[model samples]
Target: MHILILGAAGMVGAKLLQRLARDGQLGGKTITKATLHDVVEPTAPEGCPFPVEAHASDFARPGEAERLIAGRPDVIFHLAAIVSGEAEADFEKGDRINLDGTRMLFDAIRRIEGYTPRVVFTSSIAVFGAPFPEAIGDEFFTTPLTSYGTQKAIGELLLADYTRRGFMDGVGIRLPTICVRPGRPNKAASGFFSNIIREPLNGQEAVLPVSEDVMHWHASPRSAVGFLIHAATIDGERIGPRRNLTMPGVAVTVAEQIEALRRVAGEGVVARIRREPDPTIQRIVAGWPRRFDAKRAEGLGFKAEAGFEEIIRIHIDDELGGRFVA
Candidate 1:
């Protein structure tokens, strides 16, 4: 099978690339070729059994999407987008990269004759607006308040419609806030969810821009990568016409998260988290969904960390070499 991965330089994209290189296959088939595309050139993985190509290209450009789709890869993992904060702050850039770019990809695929590849789209929980119940259900209506979420909602609709038309086999998974993201924080309004755990674990101070009682759905980097793989490989027919599904994740508050860090590392690590609320981030996060039922994802075989405690351990294992200064 030939595979194409867009946004291959980001955290999740890079991890997915590493996983693919390690296994050298996807969905029980040997990968014959892999193309990695990003706004900037992605690194080509070495020592792979199959040929690998990395390109610096923008899908939003007129002909770029068509060029990327020309070879008709067996599977296409679409993970490119402007994050919520940046998208909300810059409407034009968000629309160009997130909305128009996705449409271009779909249209490019439609232009392909007799090519129906499996597509795994990485969606976000921000698609659901505020006034949520204790848990957001699978049937919850999406009323996105943020531009990023709005773009993803539109993408989900397009994926379903395109799949029904037989242009592509598409699966959209709404991922939770990926906690303990292994890098410097990006411009995401939700970056604090990972920052609180990641920086402190590294013996660096992290600012908490929200209250301790603030709750949100979360998953580990490991679980995020797993969700993408499962969505790519699962039986599309079983997914039915819904096409898009919310992934399962742990529901925990900032207090519970810090407690978990304390348990895993020590009070010193947890103490590194400073409480200095940013009203803008607080307002944005307050408008986001804090929990999810995730029954459909559970039934569909998607999994996540059991709780905040387990999430912390997964981060240590995956990004910290299983050790941290207490």
Candidate 2:
């Protein structure tokens, strides 16, 4: 199978690339070729059995999406986007990259004759806005309050409609805020979720821009990649017409998250978190859904870490060499 991965330079995208390179196959089929695309060139995985190509360009530009889709990959993983905070801050950029880019990709695929590739889109839980039920479910309506969320909501609708028209085989997974994200933080409004845990463990001070009482849904990077792989390979017929589903995740308050960090690491590590509230981030996060039922995704074989503590341990194992500075 030939695979194409957009946004392969980002954290989640990079991890997915590494996982695919290590396995050299998806589901059960050997990968004969792979292409990685991002605005900034992504690094090709080393020592791969098959050829790997990395391209850098603004895919939202006219003709760009068509060029990427010309190879007619069997499986397309679309993880590219302007993240939450960045999107909310720059409306036009968000609209162009998140909304127009996705549409262009779908249209490019449609233009091809007899090409129906499996498309796995990485959406966000941000698509669900506030006034949420105790647990947001698959049946709940999307009422996004942020530009980023709005973009993803539109993308989900497009994916379903395109799939219904038989233009492509699409699976959209709405991922939670992936906690303990490795490496330095980006502009995502949800970055603080990972920051408070990651920075403290590294003996660096992290600023908590929101209250301890604040709650949110979370998963580990490991689970995020697993969700994408399952979405790519699962029987699309079982998914039915509801092509987009929320991936399962753990729900916890900031206090609970700090405690989990303390349990996994130590008090000294926890001490590194200094409270310095930022109203902008607080306002943005306030509108996001804090919990999800995600029954549809769970029944569809999607899974995530059971709780915040396990998420911390996974970060240590995967990114911190299985240990931290106590």
Candidate 3:
């Protein structure tokens, strides 16, 4: 089996590549090739048993999507997108990359002759609008609040339609905000969520962009990678024509996250966090869903971190060598 990962340089994409390379197989078949594509060339994973190809290409650019799809990979992980903050800030770039790029990729796959790959698209919980119910269910209607959310919701619709037409087998996993992400903060509005814990653990000061009571959905990087792998391997027949499902994750408030930090790194480290609420972030977060029912994903065998404490532990072990307070 051949696997292709777009947005291969992003945090989730990079982690997924490592996971796939380590396994070297999917759906009981040995991986013959792994292709990683992004605007910038992705760093090739070390010790990959199969051939790994890293290419720099923009899917929205002319002929780029077709060229990348030429290999007819059995599994395509479309994890590429401009993040929430950046997308909300830059209208044109976001539309080009998030909305247009997705269409091009799906269209390219649809035109392929006798080729039907399993497209595991990484959607976001942002698909739910502001005025959300206490817990959003599988049947909840999509009413995106941000341009980024709108684009993701649009992508889900396209995936379902494409799958319905028998062009490809699509599984759109609406990911929760991945916490304890391994790396420096980017421009995402949700970056502060990880920063509060990540920075303090590293003995650095981090900002709190919203009130402590602000709640939201979360999952670990490990679980996010697991979702991609499972979506690729799971029986799509059970998924039926829906093609999109909200992934299960822990629901926690910012106060709970701080408590987890205090538990792990002690109160002193947690004290390093400074609170300077930004109303823009508050408004943006206000429209986001705080929790999800995610019954469909759970039934389909997807799992998430038990709690914020476990999430922090995963971060410390995976990225901090299980030691802090230096």
Candidate 4:
């Protein structure tokens, strides 16, 4: 099988690439080739059994999506997007890349006479706004409060409609805010969720932009990659016309997250967090969903960490080499 991963240089995308290179297969078929795409060149996984091609280009540019789709890869992982904060800050760039880029890719797939590849779109919890239920469910309607969420919501609709028209086998998974994200933080409004824990474990200070009581849904980087793998291989007929589902994750408050960090890495590490609230970030987080009843996705075999502590441990094992600063 041939695979294509958009946003291949991004955190999750890069991890997914490493995973595939290690496994060297998807859905029981051997991977023969892979094409990586991003605004900047992506680093292909080393020692892969298959040929990995990396391309640096704007897929949203006219004719660009078409050029990338010309390969007709068996599975396409669409992970590219301007994150929440950046999207909210730059409306034009967000709409161009997140919304227009998605549509162009879908249209390009339809133009192919006899191709209907599996398309796994990485949507977000941002798709649901405030006034949410105690736990947002699969049946809840999307009422996005931010430009980034609105853009993702639009992409979800397009994925379902295009799949209904038989243009592609689409699965849109609304991922939780990935916690303990590896490496330097980007512009995501949710970055602080990872930062407060990540930096502390590295013996560095981190800013706490929101109050400790602020609650949100979360998952580890490992689970995020697992969601993509299952979405790519799962039976589309089983997913039905909805075509989109909220992924499973742990729900915890900032206070609980800090407690979990203390449990895993000790009080000294947790002490590195310094609270200096930013109303802008707090307001953005205020409009996001806090928890989810993701039974629908769970039933389909999607899984996540049972608690925030487990999530933190997974990060320590995967990225910290199983140890942290005392």
Q: Global lDDT of each model?
A: 0.90, 0.92, 0.90, 0.93
RMSD of each: 1.2, 1.3, 1.3, 1.2
Q: For candidate 2, lDDT tens digit of each residue in 201-281?
A: 888999999999999999999999999999999999999999999999999999999999998898999999999999999
Cα lDDT over the full model 4? 0.93
TM-score, one value per model = 0.97, 0.97, 0.96, 0.97
RMSD, model 1, all Cα superposed?
1.2
Number of the top-ranking candidate, with lDDT as the measure = 4
Model 4 TM-score (2 dp): 0.97
| Candidate 2 wrongly placed segments (more than 4 Å) | none
Model 3, position 98, has a per-residue lDDT of 94
* Arranged by lDDT, best first: 4, 2, 3, 1
Q: TM-score of the candidate numbered 3?
A: 0.96
Across 185-242, the per-residue lDDT of candidate 4 in tens digits comes to 6556788999999999998999999999998999999999999999999999998999
Candidate 3 lDDT: 0.90
Clashes of each: 0, 0, 0, 0
lDDT of 3 by residue, 1-326 (tens): 99899999988999998888888888789999988899899986889889988898778996788988898999999999988878988989999999999999999998887888999999998888868889998999999888999999999999999999988899999999999877897657788999988888888899998999999899999999999999999998999999899999999999999998788779888988999999999987787899999999999999999899999999999888888763
What is the clash tally of candidate 1? Answer: 0
Model 1 steric clash pairs: none
